[model samples]
Target: MHVLITGAAGFLGQRLVHALAACRELDGQPLSRLTLVDQVEAPAPEIAGVECVARAVDIAAPGALDASLDEHPQVIFHLAAVVSSAAEADLDLGTTVNFEATRALLEGCRARKLSSTRLIMASSVAVYGGDLPDVVEDMTALTPQSSYGTQKAMCELLITDYSRRGLVDGRVLRLPTIVIRPGRPNAAASSFASSILREPLNGEDAVCPVPTDLELFVMSPRRVTEALIHGAEVAGEAFGPSRALMLPGITVSVAEMLEALRETGGEAALARVRHEPDPRIEAIVASWPARFINARARELGFQGDANLRDIVESYLGERD
Candidate 1:
């Protein structure tokens, strides 16, 4: 198996790389070559039998990924994007990277006639918005409210079309807000979700930009990485007419997250958190559906955290 991952320097990408390194195989074949791509050169993990190639390239630039595509990776995990708040703030940057770059990648696969290639893209719950049902389903209409969501929704359609045309096998996993991410905050509107707990647990003050009652559909980094890998192995026909899958996640409110933080990090940690509203972030997050009935994903054997406490503990365990 030749596996290539974009956005390979990001936290989630790095985690996925390590997970793949440990497994050393995918879809019943041994991983022989692993190519990591990002704006910055990703660290090449030293897998015993696998050749690791780390390339620094702007995937949005013309012919940027041509060399990597020449290698003809069996599986491509497309995880690169400009994130939410940043995308909303800069439409041009968002469109170029999120939408155009994705279309280009699909075109790359089509041009090379890599019909056996499986492209697993990381989408988001942000794709669902405006007058949503209490429990959103996989086939629900895509009514995106933000530039980031719109771009993702567009990519989902392109992937589906390409799959239908026999150009490429595509799997679109619509992810939930990943909670308890390690490291400093980025530009994602959901960054606060992880920051609140991560900062307080590290004995620093943190802000809550949304209301305490505001709810979000969330997953842990562990489960998201697992889904990425599993998405590659599932039969393409299993997706039927649509190639998109809304991953299963738990619906948690800001209050519940803080409570979980309190349970894991004690009173001092809880005291470190302060509430201050930011309407910009609040509107973006508010537009997203907080509940989902991902029956299809559940039937397909996808899993989520047991509860928020476990999510918090999972981060703590990793840190320890």
Candidate 2:
């Protein structure tokens, strides 16, 4: 099965491309091609036996995205977006890139009507609102706070409607904040989550953007990638509602995280981190839900590792 992966140059995008390239799950049927699309033409990873196409695709620019959809990929991983903090700061750019661009891609998919294509959307936990109680909340009613959250929630509804109308098979996975991401801080509102761990591991000082008591949801990159693949390959009947699934992730406070780093990476790692909260950032982080139920996906056999330390170890590995 050939696949199209958007946001190919970004952190999780690059890893997903590499993982799928190494995947052998098409029942021994070799993958025919791998199409990597981003705003700019990014470097392609060498995958010896598969056809790979890397293209510069700008969804906001007229006709640019449509031109890149020619390959008729059987499966799609859509991870392209402007982060919440950036989206909030620039409303016009936010709607165009995060919301409208998604619709454009979906419309393109519908227009092409590739019977075999399954669109896997990478949504965020930001779709939900407020600090969740220590217990998980009901997944039915979605109340989003930030403009980014509202956009994602709306897209979720649109994706379901499109799927219901047979436009395409849409599987949306609402993601937890991906922690211990092994790179420089990104535009993501959750960038601080990764910074607290990744920076310390790199032996660099990282400023904690929120207080130690601040809590949020999290998932490892490996788990996030696995969910994307499962969403694409799993049967609709088994999945029932092909709409978004609120993912169950590791929920911990900023303090718990620091403690985790201390236990795992020792005093050196702990010493490298400093506390310095940005009020704007804190407000955004404060508005986001700390955990989600995701019982629907769990019932369908989707699950994550039990420890945050696993996420830490994965990022610390020799491989990127």
Give the alpha-carbon lDDT of every model: 0.92, 0.79
Native-to-model Cα distance after best TM-score fit, residue 47 in candidate 1, in Å:
1.1
Score candidate 1 by TM-score against the native: 0.96
Largest TM-score belongs to which candidate?
A: 1
Candidate 1 Cα errors over 4 Å, as ranges: none
Best candidate according to lDDT:
1
- TM-score between candidate 2 and the true structure: 0.92
Q: For candidate 2, lDDT tens digit of each residue in 132-225?
A: 5655554446777778888888888888878878788788888888876776887666788999888887778888888788888888888888
List TM-scores for all candidates, in order. Answer: 0.96, 0.92
For every model shown, the clashing-pair count is 0, 1
**Model 1 Cα lDDT, one tens digit per residue, 1-320:** 99999999988899999999999999889999999999999988999999999999999899989999999999999999998778988999999999999999999999999988999999988788888887788778999888989999999999999999999999999999999888987777889999999999998999999999999999999999999998999888788788998988899999999998888889999999989999988987888888889887887778888999989888989988
